[model samples]
Target: MDRETRLQALSAFLKAKRAKIPPESIGLAPGTRRRTPGLRREEVAQLAGVSTTWYTWLEQGRDIRVSRSVLDSIATALQLNIDERKYLYDLTLESGSGATLWKEESPEISPSLKKIMNELRYCPTIITDRRFFIVGWNEAASCVFLDFEQIPFEQRNMIRLLFARKELRRLAVNWEHFTRGYLAIFRAYYGQYVEDEWYDRFLEEMKRVHPDFDHLWQQSEVKTAPDVLIEFRHAKAGKMMFHLTSLQVQGSADLRCSIYTPDPDSPTENKLKKLMERK
Candidate 1:
């Protein structure tokens, strides 16, 4: 949708949703002789902890910059569900303002590059685009975590896998901690392509399928590329510790290669070796 139309729809949608919430529902007195059926513009602004003028401007469809935090507050105040909240973001956040963070076409992995990834027998390595779509992975990666080759291409997303896949959750020793960091990085990446179709669809599908994602997403956390120690509980290998490293592919700025190396001093190294031997 064009910017103007998006803004207009945002204004209308907010007003409609706002009207559905009663003052009594939020522990506010329903003042007598109310001209409107629901809360007033000022009430919404007050509840959302934003300025009345700013809320008014938004309701009027003014071309004002909206932050994710502010949108979260407004959505909360309006009692918006996941779908509505997503719609609010899509409408208010104009896509034209941000730089294109993703390529129009997915990058192809050369046979040589694929071979190199596979040759990293000791390190579990996987390649993904900016959007976290798995482009390629080494056998060690499959042995360590999931066999991405078995998953459908459309569902081969790190974020989606983390949120929607039960096996990954079970495998992670620190699932919550790991996901928080992972999501923060994902959110930071998402900011670069808030208006992109792939992002839009990804957000919608995630929110629809994983209820927890919406709550976490609304937190608006952000983090840059991170290096940390991760522990995974493999059914066959037991608990394994790895130092994770994320690096940008040399020529493909949009693509990244993540390698997990077993801690040299820890038993994780021996465990990985045995896992590879078994494979």
Candidate 2:
């Protein structure tokens, strides 16, 4: 992105983050009925230990050099989480070094990783690209989830399936809760890779097709890929729960392997086994 465009994006991101924080959260008393939703510009400048005019200029998308220490102070003032702080850096920093680890091109899975995935007969494992495209999967994954081969290659994205396919949503128990976390991670990725035009196109398509997507996107939630538990109401096997674990491929920075292990507390194993046998 050009300097001016990047500044504009940074401006929007800062405004969004600022709007979420309440006065009471930062030990500031609600002195009066505020004109704006969040902590005022003066309040943030005071908290961040920067001049209000300078901060205002920064927020206004002015061409100003921001130092790391100043950015750190602003991050602290905003109470940014790890992912959000990183995103903040990616936006303000000129080098864009924060996003250096991510590659825009499609990732290639190694033979060894493919072999390992295939060996885990009981575990439903699938590999996804940076955009959560289902690039690879095992027989167990096909059995547990839908047969990926049946779907068009272009429609293999996890987000696409979750929002577009009603059957998948129906199968997932507590779909909103599961998808919220997914969306949070996706948002972080989108912010870091703001230069990617594909993200904008995909986002526009999603907003047009799915009504709930715009609402979720507007929340500005950021999250890292943490282990999560998901329960699926299978038509044939009945109730099945799995603990989802995501791992980054060693050599491929753009790929993530998700393995679904049956929850010990539930009868997911036997049900999965029986379901796999039928397949």
Candidate 3:
């Protein structure tokens, strides 16, 4: 209801950004008279599919509730790039804007792909869409997820491991700094997908299930975990080094083929080999 700060910040950012642009740069006629310069407020509103009054209120730091859809449209109108778009989204959230983005996308990885995952049963694998929805999981993944199964599915977000689950938190060697960067990396990779219903539900469920995770989420820091230090507690091996690999699924922009490789000499490789032999 009261998102005045976001409106104000965005207004300032837009105003500052807009000032640098000349009307001629965008092919607009250099009107005979201009006050604030660079394509008037009316022009911006028209281009952004918003009413002039709405745009004015937004720039003036007034209380204006903006939906994610409208923000996307405005970002498009302003020609924001990936980082800029995310920053804009963050600004709104920082201002206490409460419209959570949670769009749902059905699992779409192929049955053939599932078979491929089965073929690599020795390797831990899972399929997640852009919004972090877990569509599929191989045996290795099942162990980790199963450990956390008591947590509600809607809130089974990966970020919770950093703050909520004490055991998992212990697994992360450099918890504090690692989390700071990982949060940003998460936003960079997943912020674009946050407007989905599934994502919103995921956050809500996480907040309900683990208040600690919710606290970290509120901090809004973003970063990615380092590749080398991440270790996993294996059900069979006790503990193992996992190398995460993500292969982009062509044609489907959101789908990623994620695989985990245990260290060659680590007990995991031997354990996996034994499983394959048993099969």
- By lDDT, the best candidate is 2
* Per-residue alpha-carbon lDDT of candidate 3 for residues 1-279, written as tens digits (9 for 90 to 100): 223433544566666555655888768988888877766877778878999999878767676687888888777766666665776776665532223432344456687888999888667776655555456677756554344345555555556555566765655445664454445555544444433334455556667986665555554443332344346654444566667666656554456666778777677777666654653
lDDT of 2 by residue, 1-279 (tens): 556766876787788889989899988887678887889988899999999999999889998989999999999998999988987787788544244556655577789988999998889998987778888999989987789999977889998898887877887899887787778777767766766656667888999999998877767777767688898998888888999887777664567788999999999989888888888
* Alpha-carbon local distance difference test for all models: 0.78, 0.82, 0.60
Model 2 Cα RMSD, 1 decimal: 3.0
Model 3 poorest ten-residue lDDT run:
95-104
Q: Give the TM-score of candidate 1.
A: 0.65
TM, every model: 0.65, 0.86, 0.51
The backbone clash count of each candidate, in order, is: 0, 0, 16
Q: Using TM-score as the measure, what is the rank order of every candidate, best first?
A: 2, 1, 3
- Positional deviation of 119 in candidate 1, in angstroms? 3.9
lDDT of 1 at 9: 52
